[model samples]
Target: MMSDCPVVSTKLGKVSGFALAKAKCPEAQQVYGYLAIPFAKPPVGNLRFKPPQSADAWKGTRDGTKYPPGPMQSTRYVEIFAKYVANYRVADENPRYFDEDCLYLNLFTPKTSNKAKLPVLIWFYGGGFSAGSSVGYHGQTICGLQDVVLVVPQYRLNAFGFISFGKNSSCPGNMGLLDQKMAMEWTRDNILAFGGDPNNVTLFGRGSGGISVSSHVLSPMSRGLFHRAISCSGVANCNLVTKENNDVSTGFLLKELGIMDRDPEIILAKLRSLSAKALMEAQEISAEYHENPLQKLDDFVTVVDGKFLSKHPRDLITDGNFAPVPFIIGCNNTEFCGVLADRFPKGFVTGEIGEKQAMDLTKIAWQVADNIPSNKLDEGVGLVKKEMMRYISPDDRYKWSKLPTNVMLDTLILLPGVEQAIAHSDAGNPTYMYYMTQQLRMHHNRAFSKDMTKKPEFCEADHIDDEVFTFGVPFGNGPVAKEMKFTEDEKNLSKQWMSFICNFAKTGNPNTPMSLTNWTSFKRDDQRHLVVKMPLEEGVDLMGERFEFWQNLRAKMATT
Candidate 1:
């Protein structure tokens, strides 16, 4: 049946895609998937730390069914993928996979006829700058649902992608971002052949990838790449920024490899001499700087390089210099709660006064950002506690007082999301915001692995749950859905969510699809955001008092 699919002729060569009959779309005969096309030359040898080059055009048809190897990353991510991720399809089963020559892109088209030029949806994956692959997302069914073309590009990671050495061309940092830019350029030049409209491209991603999309919004180099963006659970102002002169971390890594010199040229040569695996293993930055939450979470992240990113991303967004495009931004309610819940003792959540008092304010506040001063950390924590008190009834204080889940959610996900939405709205671009509230039937934490086959228990909408609904993969159709036995509520919610995203891609406005509820654009004054649940509810002030507390504290934090 797959042999019936047409062969696409690109400038490089002729390649035929596999027919995807499993797609849930009834309008299309079948979706075609063209996998593992090289978008850039391998970043090997001298090209290791430099920006990616154009892929060398080939003479013969390459096998497009098999996914290309992903960028170099630690194998621990594979375990994390199995343990934590909810929607990993068959393509994502490769746990022990990594390579340097992994600059590839996968394209999925719903067009049964080559004459149709559909809108394009390009996805960038997130793994704290260390892990993720384009193969994980089963994009065929998702794209087929709306007859849109989907593109997923692989970029370098960790030491290979983000090891900055003070802004010179030899070892300039942000090579990962440059790789994304190169992929966009390739799409701009070649996507039409795959039946995609280059002008109607939408770039979207979750977590680190979402931050990358926000970074692209601020970068001058990514201006003409895409016309719209959908960033979920990550933003530039969320303290995700790393230091530009990351010499402290890079130098420490170089010294570990017996290269003690501070000279850029010498360090570059030494770095190139080391094997990819060895270099990846040498990514041990000092823990002394753990006070800074960003450094503690992911030190090797995007930086404000002079070329790719000239200024601080938040400053750029505030100054209205970012790409003027429609945006859909949201975050899960309890994103990191269950992940960190066990760290606190049982008495912590039970509101034992002594147990609550035992918890250190400075350490907890540091998790928010390293910039908070010692004098102000306790005060901020006190303010947060007071706000939480108001939300919980006097009878429920014991149940709510333990493990600062609300604090973490507000500091990391909510504050930054709302801030970015406000900034984007102020910059004269239409922005839509939402808070995902539906609890999903999946694992809350990786600790429970007794029966991986039996579906994990239901948990509050945690991080990356939105991706499952957005992609429309195994859940979109197949035996997995039959096995999982999704509820009517789950199916309805996924359909609504996918419809909203598809509508946004087709028309800049998401409100075009009258079948769905009327979604309103966010403004500074109204601050309206759709509370996404089974029956979607609109609210003007989401966590109003808590938001106000943070808004006031941010000014003081800025002054300090």
Candidate 2:
């Protein structure tokens, strides 16, 4: 009989965890879960906008069964998008369920002796660093499948997390990243008690979470914390990750909140006094004032603070100053298709957006992707359109309608990911790359099928498609699983995908234990990358023409 509860003793105190239900991890005999383990003290009161403090020692056994409240954030946009656009359910983020003092982690480990020393995988969730929770991603399946320990850590979000008041102020930037660093430190110190090998840990995340993983690789403060890194869809060099003029944004925020003080100390004090809801509201309002299109995507994001990040990630990587760890980086084939579909619903459904509308949207996309000056905007748009038209005929209305999405795929996600991989490989670090082309069953575009009664055969994979399979969602009982009806082949594919991830975490190479295809390591000379889908074929020079077009265009733009 399984024990009603499993107890583990840590440096702080003893804690009790519950056994995972059999349905959650069907293959394993038992898996233990310890939820809501406090890694840092509450960042409230005077500690707001400050680095996380170590958790205080507790006297008695603490209950680690119930989930802690999610980090404070405004979930209105994400909630609407998930429900209406994606036709999917998101983790509940009820206002009452969010709290400012949300610095906790959830851990799952297979049944083993304390000395098992299994590999550790820490997940940093993605929500543009403004909204997300550790509640939805259950670790039971991964832990049970691979004899590994999975941990999900929660960090501060929105204004409370990334708001910076410039240098030498009471509030420096990247408190959210500092929260992640602290959680990593906590895992390093205490994971041994949970049968995990701290020295052999892997940090993996998607979207903004992926950016966090890549940021840690470049951060001097994060060295020696983890052995390997995996960034699924976002990288530090992408347009989404920016070192914006935070002073302007900070000023907007303070002015919105009726605090127009220029003094950092005064600003900090006033911000600390406001309620969490009020600060979040101010962040939402101030975000509208940002003219930079990239900042609109993520106003509160990772910055090159002198302490956490001394220089730009590109310069650091080129100078060989980043952590020398094995890396795996990739993105979905058409990462922005769903975004484009939602943005222009009629165009996608009708499959005819007309040439004028396509060109206009493409111009806007070019502005966002390349930051072309107003005088040179038309020139840049013409260059992009010329190259895009080379692949598709001028009269093909259906393909023309989707031109902007294609531009975003290359300029925003694919190009950045490939550049990072080449840089990492050139810097003498082992690097692996993948291009996820397999369309997920729960893909948002499926909802837009002309025949709503029948399932749509969408071919392109959108953003976060890789994440669904990476977490074994198809086989688990999460909200995503409830919506997706997986076939036997897809379930097997998920199992295979999880094996590759686990194998990488365990040995720093994905093709360990066994693999259907020999996964090749990425090299600058050949630019080899795996085309991840059914059968898993190895491909060389992924998007060679498109990558060259963007690279040459960027070079030309830089010179001009």
Candidate 3:
């Protein structure tokens, strides 16, 4: 099960990575790990905004026992930074990391068997479009037992990765997506040497990574890059910025950057040329931009760029543009309650600043969207803003749960799951859905604030609860994280997820004799949900009546 060879090699040289878990650590002695490994040449200097090129050949052996720093970091989340460094460990002498010259990936195999080409599972980390790395509290045992190739690639993010230069062919954006495409192509060509089956690849990601994977599944440019898809705890939403299209979104950015006139080409060119630090500093002016995930999402995301991405990923999925491959997509039980604990004072049932007032605020909020027809923009951005305000800011934060809870109940939990379920059902793909109800032995209140904590009767299946179990990495080494080891129930859940994923990778269908009992596929007519509940019972429906009401509201929104 252990191998002393690097999974990938090129002209530069043969870098060797050892199986730390299976070879060194007795606790994880059964798990095989290939640490920091390169997939493409470093993107720096002249190659900064360009596509990935080959790295120079190395004459001697390269030691890839550690992960390279990825992209950049911000100062706000000190705790998060500590966790990141801890996960992406480095030698003691070199502490400061985070660079653009990180085009490496780490692939962990349970065992190296040349006789059989094992299934490959590629992972994408989450950090909106701003920041995140492939190394974190990710689990290694499942890959070892499941006998698959676990590939984790480090892609570009934020201004360093996605900002474009006014449609200039030379100044291309979306470098992050390009890097990912190259990694997949690398897997296709070289995975065999690592004892992995190139043809049977499943793209899996959470949060930002989920959105990225979904975009790949829906984009024509990403066709054939991967065979199956799994998007967790993320949406498939995106908006393109332009003079005519994003005046409101751009106006705020321009005002913050001290630009009076809304010049897409001139200002964008100057902004693109600015140092990464300068760009990061200036971007801080628009607080809304940083708070929202989309603004900083890799400088290069799915756009209406005629070449790589012709249309938005969501629209494509809605229009039945899926690859007919198997689909397993789900979101956390609660999403927005992440850092800004839920505190909705009013009922999301009605916007605090009503639709009319929101329309007025929209004019101020969006500085650059002067060209968008008022009625059209109001119907679009304005409406979304009004709804968001209601969800994010409640009239009260303590001793009560109003709009925040209602929004979580109505939108975050149910909508994304049911939508994708219906989409997969229409395409006749076997889509197995999941609801993460298992609360951490600790942090039940920390996630959504003690005030907004659910009743003991009502379990917290909060936004990040799944990450703990899914990755086998503790979020905060709290007493619960340290003491509350995975019990038989948690192990069963993990095994169930593995069974579904492994079977799906092995065959097109994930249905098996040991499937969760009564868990049903999405039915457009019946509208039944196989709610995953405590004690892990199936057919335990969620807030079914409220969900149906919300679903109808969504249908009505589309028609109007």
Candidate 4:
């Protein structure tokens, strides 16, 4: 049985994989999965906060059958959110073991020879750079259906992945991103043995993973490693990407860990000496120091390291100092619905919010003025609140609830998406933009409410809705599929979506197959975007007024 397994000789060693069960991917032509192949040496012990090192060659064939343990992270919030709001289970949600040594990758391929020359898609899972794993997403369906090779890499999470102590410190930031870079380099050298075209590689991801894709495009270190890019629901300029001082963040974590040393060498030695569990626990406690609500989303985040990133991503993109590759970027219609529901459950359940609640929410929405001076903060907040209030009627409570949700959707997701698209298109990159409008059938939020009875004026698509379709979850027999029901139309939609994505991966254009509607290139003047739904429709100027409002706000903040 051991000898019967499929084995491929990589640059480092020989690794064996198992044939995917037919039940897992009924539509797949032929998919073989090589799971948990070590791409870099484990980021553990003495190498804890340093950049990833290439894995050493092995003496014999390595077993890659079992899924790797998820990178170390606190899972309390993930479990609650997944079960209640998202209405789906996260694959390998909480494994029996978690570790700092989580730098492995899973490969699914249709051809196992160097001559197959299939296109390759490498995915980075999105957990806001705090919590997520490469375990649950099965690439068998994508590889089998699209005739390509799919790779999902695991990186360090939480403080272990992104801890930094400023310019003079030994611990520069972006360990997670560096881990992804190492994986790409490894793939470039060894994917041909797995029947993949190293030259035709495409990087795609959602949420923070999407942000990572955009970051790679801006980084000098990541140039020439990937050819094309796809970012869903997030980009480098998204509000979720933090602008906090990393030195302050590191100081907070040190305080939480009871370390008072001010010396960089002493701090690095102390941090490296702590156990993974101790570091993770301290990172969680350090959240109290971040006063900004948005900054608290993820305590550890990517920084503009001089080597990996020479300047801010927005400045780099504006100055045309990035890898100009074919890009696909967009977000769901209501990317913040779940967060709204979780935050104001009563308002969502009742379809109404108190006047005070509405005003408080408006102030929170205006926090996007992160650069506004303290002297002008009150004036700016008042101006935004006044404009936002005009959209809501005093007699209607539902309007009150909808106002904040709309503002959040605009600031956090939609505005950033449009800005990134405009930047890429203006710089002469072939860019395609999409807006997902198809709502999931299983979850009934009714515009950010848990109540199924209340029907909103329109259908709303929540965060990760596009990812669900992109990964072909509806048609597969995985944990996500078992939790919910999918209609015949939804299943078919998943197929079409995968086709478009794989087509882009193969040819750098989604419309090459010509089976679906023609997706036009996004232009600076036109600003057209594809409305992703059944019987796909085309439109121009998605949420124009809201986009302009944010633009005006930024302009005013700059002048004041």
lDDT (Cα, 0-100) at 122 in candidate 4:
94
Put down candidate 3 lDDT per residue, 42-158, tens digits, no spaces.
Answer: 876556667677555666667666667766544443233332122212122122366767788777765555546888888887665566776553335556446677888888865
Misplaced by over 4 Å in model 4 are 1-5, 23-27, 84-96, 242-244, 372-375, 386-397, 445-459, 478-482
lDDT minimum window of 10 residues, candidate 1 = 449-458
TM-scores of all predicted structures:
0.89, 0.92, 0.75, 0.91
Tens-place lDDT digits, model 1, residues 234-260:
877665444455555665566667786
CA RMSD, predictions in order = 3.6, 3.3, 6.7, 3.4
Clashing pairs in 4: none
- lDDT tens string, model 4, 1-560? 33444799998889988776432446567667787889999888889989999898897988877888889987654653454332222233444367888999989888888899999999998877887888666665677788989999998876788887764567778889999999999999999999899999999998889989989988889989999999987887754464433666777888888899888778888888888888887787786688755555566888877767667676777788878899998888766665336555375646666766765665666574245455766677667667766766766647667666766777766777788888888888899998888877756533333433222433367776676688776656434423455666667777888888899999888886555678888987777878888878887877667677878888888786
Ranking by TM-score: 2, 4, 1, 3
Tens digit per residue, CA lDDT, model 2, 1-560: 12575688989998888776543445754578887899999999999999999999998988887778989887754552343122122223232378998999988888546689999999998777877878676665677677789999999987788888765666778899999999999999999999999899999998889889988998989999999999988887764564633666777788788886777888788888899888888888888887754465577776667788777666677777788899999888777565435555365645656767777777767666666676777777888888887877666656666677778777766787787788888888889999888865544334423222221233366776676677666656424322455556556677788888899999989996479888899997778888888868898987778888898887777678
lDDT of 4: 0.76
TM-score of 4: 0.91
Q: Give me the runs in candidate 1 sitting further than 4 Å from their true place.
A: 24-29, 88-93, 112-114, 284-297, 339-370, 374-376, 393-403, 444-459, 477-483
